[model samples]
Target: MGAVIRYTTDGSDPTESSIRYTGTVSVSAATTLKAKAFKSGWTPSQTATAAYTMSISDTILFSPASGEYHSEQDVVLSCAVPDAIIRYTADGTEPVESSSPYTKPVHISETATLKAKAFKSGWSPSQTATSAYTMSISDTILFSPASGEYYSEQNVSLSCNTVGVTIRYTTDGKTEPTINSMTYTAPIAVSETTLIKAKAFRSGWNSGTVAEGNYKLRLPDCITFSPEPGTHFSNQKVVLSCSIPGTKLYYTLDKSEPDKKSIPYTEAISVSETALIRAKAFRKGWSPSPAAIGSYEMAIPQDCIRFMPAPGTYTEAPTVEVSCECGIPDVVIRYIINDSGSEDTLYSSPILLSESATVKARAFKEGWTFSNISQGTYMLKVKEPVILPGSNTSVTQQEVQISSETPGSAIYYTTDGSEPAENASLYDKPFSVSQTSIVKAKAFKIGWETSGAVSEKYTIKAAKPVFSLESGIYTGLRTVAVSCETPGAKIHYTTDGSIPSKASPCYDSETLVSLSKTTTLSAKAFKENCEPSEETEAVYRLKITTPQISSDAGGFSCETAEIRMLCEFPDAEIFYTTDGKMPTESSSVYDEPFLATGYVTVIAVAYKPGWEPSDAAVKHIAVKGDINGDCSADMSDVIAGLQILTGTDSAPIRSDYDYSEADLNGDGRVGSAEIVYLLMAISKK
Candidate 1:
C-alpha cells in the first residue's frame, strides 16, 4: 500500500477525480475500490484493487461437527460478534442484505448445503460458511422370522447391523419404554399380533433409524382326546393322539420329572380310576412339541387330595406326598408342578421338589368322581443376612454405601425423608449431597425379610449460590435466576450491595432476577438445621445514554442548516426524528449531513442498551426569503416571483426552495402565492 494512493469510488480509472488515500473509507454495503499510486507528476503506477462488503449478519459457526447424519438435527448457527444479524439458506446461492435472518436454530430435515453469513453496520461483511448435511442410517435391524402369522407361539430374535450398539424393542406400539416393551437381549415370545418396533443406540452418536414389524402366533395342533376330557366312567379306555409326525410320546404315573426314563406309551391302558392325562413329544434339534393336557373323572367315589408335610419355606426339598382317601383301592393321583401345565405327572408315590412350587393335584378311580383339587405353595429358605454400611452423620460426607453379606442380596435406599423402597432410584454409585438428607437402606434376598431398613443421616455444609447470568455489561433489561445445590436451602439476596441475612428478601420459590439499572446483586443461601452459604455478588452495568447535538436548537433564519450529534457512551449510536415520533434504536442514524429546506423541526435521541437513554435534542430552523439562494431576498426576488406569475420567467418555483430553507409557507415552492404569504407573515412579525 502506498501513502499517496488515489482511489476511484465509481469503479473507473483513477484520475484527478479520485480521492487521495488518507485513512479508511467506510461503505454501507459491498463495494470495489480501484486505486493508483501517484507522486508529484511521476508516472502513475498500475491500478490496485480492493473490495469490501457490509451486510446485516456475520459469518456462522455450527455445532456437533458436520457429517452425513441419519435423523433430525438441531443445527445451531452462531457468530462471535454481539448484535450481529445472521442469515442462512440451505440452497446454495449468494445471499443478499435482506436474506432470512437467523432466529432460534436451523433444523435440517434432509441433505443440503447450509450457507450462512453475519452482518452488522460499520463492519465489513464476513465470509460465508457452508455445512453440508446428508441423511444417513447408522445401523439397520434384522428381525428373524420377520413380522407375520405363525402356527403357534413363536420365538423372535433381533439383530443390529452395527456392532457396539444396544437395541431396544417395543411391543406396546409406543415409542417410550414400558413394562412390556424392554431393551432387547435375547429371544422374545410372541403369541399375538404384536407390532414390534426397535431402535439401535450407541453413545456419542445419533440414535439409529427405527424399524418395525407385526407378528402373530396361533395354536392349531392341539391334542385330540378319543374319550372327551371330562367326567368319564371307570374302566373307560381313552386314546390320546398327537398331530405332529415323528414325535416320541412320553407319560408319567408318579407326579415326578418326566424324561426318557418315564413310562413310554406302547398301548392304551384301561382306566379303572380317575386320571388326568398330560403328554408331549420331542424330536431331534427341534423345540419340544407343545405339551397337551386333559382331565377325566372316573365314575367312582374318591376323597380330597392332601400333602404329607405342611407347605412352608424349607432349606431343602420337602418329601411331599399327594394322598387321597387312603382306603380306596387302585386310586390314581395326578399333579402339575409350578402351575407350568407342561405335563400331567402321575402322583403314585411321595415326591420331593427341589425348588419353589405351587402344586395342584386330584385323585380318580373307576366309577368314581374325581377328588377335589388341592394346592400348596412352598418357598426355599433364606440364604444369609446383608451387612452394608449403614449409619452416618458427618457434615462432609455426601453419600452412604451399601453392600450384601450374602452374595445375592440387593440393596435399596431413599433420601427424601420417606421410607426406602426396593424400586426407588438405584444407588449404584456415590451421589452428591448438600443438605440434611435422611437416607434409608435395605437388603433383599429371594426368600428373606429385607434387612431392617438401615437408616442414615448426612449433615451437609452450605453451598454457594450460582447465577444464571455471569457478571458483565448488558445493553437492556435482563432477568437472572439464582440456584442452590442444596435441596432445601433458601436464597436471600439484595441489590444495594448490603450483606444478605435471614431478614433479607428470602426467595422461597421465585428464581427470576429482573434488572433495569446498573446494579450489584448480592446473595446467600440458608437452610434450617444446616449451614448458611458464603455471600456472593454480581455487577451489571447499563450502557445506553441520551444523545446530544451541537446546539440547544431553537428558531433560526437561514437558507439551510446542518447538525452534528454525539453520545457519552462508548460505541453508542445516535438516531434522529424530523416528524415528531419517539426516537428508538431503529430510527435513522446520524451519519451524514442533513439539508433543512424551508421551516423544519429536528429531534434526536441517543441509545445503546444497558445504559440510560439521553434526553431528546430538538432544533428548529426557519428561512423566510432569498428564493435565489444568495442568503437574502430583495427587489430581484420580487421581480422573479412576478415574472414567473406573469409568464415572463420560465424558471420553476421549486428551483430555489427544493434544498434551501427559504419557503416561509413550508410549501414545496417559491411561487407568487408563497411570496405574498411570506410578505404578509413578515409584516405581522
Candidate 2:
C-alpha cells in the first residue's frame, strides 16, 4: 500500500501535485529536508521513515485580479497556495483564519492597508506577506465647480483622474451628465436651472455615475427711469419712475423712502427761484443705483419804456404830449416839475405849463421805478396873429410897388403860399414887372399890432421906344453916328453888354469916323427921371469908304527915294502906280499901305482892304526934291515926261512933264532929251 500523502511546506497547505515521497526521507542537520516518505506496502511490511528539509520560494500574492475603489477603500487579503495553508491579519498580526477570512476585503472608504500569508497543513504560518493597498479616490468625475454652488451661466471647473477621461455636465438641475468631450480644466458656462454633473471614463475602466450639483438661473441686475434726464418744463409737470428685471426696486427722494401714497411726480409746480433736487433707486443682487440730481434758475419778466420830444429855440412856444408804455399791470406814472421843484401825480393826463421849464416823468410800480426826463426846454408863450398881404395881383410891362406900413419891419412874402416869418427880406421899392406875377407879403415887428396889414392891386400901361440907326460909312476905324426917331429923349448906346450910364460914350453930331468891318449898333433912349425906352433892334451893316492920305513934309531924307502916303485908317487898302495917272477899278489893288521907297512914282489910293480902289492921287516923288517942303519927289513926274515922249506912259501928260519946258532940248525925255538945246545954247555963246 502507498503511504497516504498529507503534506505541507513553507506555511502552505499541501496539494495533490505538491512534491510527495513514499520512503523515509533523510533530514540533514540543516533546516532542509531530502525525500522522506511513509509506505505501507513496501519491503515485507517494514515501516521505514526518512527525514528531509523542504525548500520554499519567496513570493507575495494578491486575492482579486483588478477592481475599483474610492479613497481610503480596504480590501480582503489572500496569497498563492503551494506548500502551506495561509492565515493573515491586516492589523500587523500573524496569520490566522479566525481573524475572519478577510471579510470581503474590508470596505475601506478612504485609503487603507492590506496584509496576507500562506500556511501548510501542519507547519506554523510562514512570515506574513504584507502590503498596503491605498484606496486612491482619483479626482475623477470632477463636479463643474470644486466647492461652492453657483448660479446658471456662472463659470465652473471639472476634472478627472484618467488622462483621456471625457467629462460631460448639465446645468438643467438634472442627474444626467451631458455628453460633451471636454477637458476638465477651466470653468464651464451654464445658463438655465442646472444640475451640474461630471463622469470620468477611459476605454478600459468602468464608466462612472453622474456626480450631481444643482444651480438656479438668474438675470443681470438693472434699474431704469421714465421721462428721461435733461427735460425742460415751462410749468413743472414731471413724472419719475424706476424699474429693473428679476428684482424689486426701492426708491428715495431727498433720502426718504417712497411709499404707495407718496407722490412720484409734481404737476403745476411753480419755480419762482432756483431749486436743487436728488433721487435714488436700489435693487437686490446688484450694485446700488446712482442718485439723479437737477438744478434750475427761473427767469424774470422784461419791461421798459422810452420817450422823445422835438428840439426848439427859447422864447418860442413848444407843446409836448406824453405817451405811456406798460409791460405789466399796476403801473402808475408821476411827474416832477424841474423848473419849480414840485411833484405832481398824473393818472393818464397831460401836464401843461405857462413858462420855460424842464419836465421829468417817472413810471412806478410796487417795487420798481423809472425816471426819464426830456432833454430840451419846454417854452410857453402867447400865440402871435398873422398879417395878410394888401396886393394879390400884378400887371405886365409896368411897375407895381408894394411897401410895408412900418419901416425897419421885415415883410415876409411868397408866391407859392407857404409859411413866412420876420426873418424874411423886407420890401422896399416897386418891382418893374414884365409877365403877370402873383405876390404876397407880411409885415412883422416886435411889440406891434400883428394884424394891421395892407395890400392893393394896380395896372400900368406899356411904353416902348422904336427907332432906326443911320449908319455912316466906316473909314477903317470903329466909329458910327447913330440917330433915333423916339421923340423928346436922349439916346444911350453901348458897344459891350454893360448897364447904360450917363458917363457912357454918346453918339453926337455927324462925325467922320474909322471902322473895321460890319457890326451891330445897339442904343436906347430915356427922358430924364422918366421910364427908359426899350432898346432898338440891332443894325447889322457894313461901312465902305476911303481914308484921307497925309505926310510930314519937313521930315524928308535925301536917302529916301520913295515917299509914303500915310493914312489914319489902319484897315484901309492903299493902291499905287508908277505912272502919273488916277487909279481906277482896273489898277492893281494894294493889300497893305505903301512903304516909302527911293524915287518911286507912286499913285496912292486909299479904300477898304477888300473893296474897290478909290480915286488915285498923283505924286512926283524925288530924292530930297522938296528942298523947301522937305518932301521927296517920285517917278510920277519923270514917267509923265517919259509918257509924253513914248506917248503910252500916260495919254494926257501934265504940264509938269512937258519936254518943251523941262527937257531944254527939242527931243523928248525932259532935261536929258534937251541936251542939244543946252549944247546949242553954249555954241551960240
My TM-score estimates for the predictions, one after another, are 0.24, 0.24
lDDT tens string, model 2, 290-392? 5555444332222333334443433343355555554446656556665455557574655554455666665565533343443344643222323333433
For each candidate, the alpha-carbon lDDT, in order, equals 0.68, 0.46
Please write out the lDDT profile of model 1 over residues 270-352, one tens digit for every residue. Answer: 66666766666665534554556666765534346778787777655578987775456888888988778598898767877
Q: Name the 10 consecutive residues with the lowest summed lDDT in model 1.
A: 382-391
* lDDT of model number 1: 0.68
Native-referenced Cα lDDT, model 2:
0.46
The number of clashing residue pairs in each candidate reads 39, 71
